[model samples]
Target: MKIGLYVLSIVCLLLIGCGDEKDSTPLVETTNKNQKPAITSKAIEDFDYTDYALSPESEEALANWEKYQELAIQIGYLKKADLSFFNGEIEDLKKFIDQFKTETPKQLLTNSIISRTAILETMLLKLNENLTLENIDDKLKLLSVRELLVAFSNLNYQINKKLESDIFNEIQPE
Candidate 1:
């Protein structure tokens, strides 16, 4: 009976010790109301294709420009979702959309980017109506916020691939 009690006490102490091990990382919440969440350490910058010497009328330039516009729309959606979560400010998101519009090349304004932008606009409107970080999952039915960010990264990769291919094609003698 004494041995049984000792074994049970040991088991109980082990269980108690295991329960005390909580995560040690400190949670640092952003105190500044105006600050945006640092989702990524790197900031997304606008790409200027003119450095590539891509002529406005060339077929490759047109294709790459179309891709660039699509990528910008994708990035816009991601930024909208992120800002909505962090700041819950509709005006900020609208301004982000405006930035994309102003940056797009005039000749490269294709139907693809326009249609995607319309969809993103509708999403922003819906988000504005029900602005809460808790409902972000429900708001973006097809993808969670993390997935949307991943999609944005993938779009960036696609743009890089297009640029690399364009450069390679230019180097090869026709």
Candidate 2:
């Protein structure tokens, strides 16, 4: 009976020890903060403007809109980088955001754009507040930030298509 109990206790201890092992990989690193990831040329190539039949003004606006999307991707990568290098990138991102805000025609402000702008602003505010690594809940916070960037990108694409349609309707002959 004593031998059986000892064997059962040893097995339980072994199971507990195995359960406690954790992977040692560091979640986020600060080393590559300065390097912006390459923006793939294919992203722009994939956009089919020819089929949209956009007016000249709409085409110009579409270019600017695409520029904003590219900048947003850069900003997303910056947001993922180390805290030390985030401020400079944030300033650059703000400037890009401001350019679209001020230069894009007021008539192009769809309800979707307004809602997305508000959400993006909120996410930026959260990011700024949690800039330090110590403050972040690694998985949850990082995932939220990533989701926000994706939402912004998808929303920006939709806004571009809507703008093209709106502009095309304005210029089309009745």
Q: Estimate each model's TM-score.
A: 0.36, 0.46
Q: What's the lDDT for residue 110 in model 2?
A: 78
Q: Taking the tens digit of each residue's C-alpha lDDT, what string does model 2 give over 1-174?
A: 999999999999999888966888878756665754232233323433332233455456756566455555565455445333233466664675676466655766777776766676666556654553455654444554455455566555656677667767889675
* Per-residue lDDT over 94-164 for candidate 1, one digit per residue giving the tens place of the 0 to 100 score: 77657655665564355554554455555544545443554454325323333434433443444345555
How does model 2 score by TM-score? 0.46
Q: In model 1, state the lDDT of residue 117.
A: 48
Instruction: Please give the CA lDDT of all the candidate structures.
Output: 0.49, 0.57
Clashing pairs for predicted structure model 2, backbone only: none
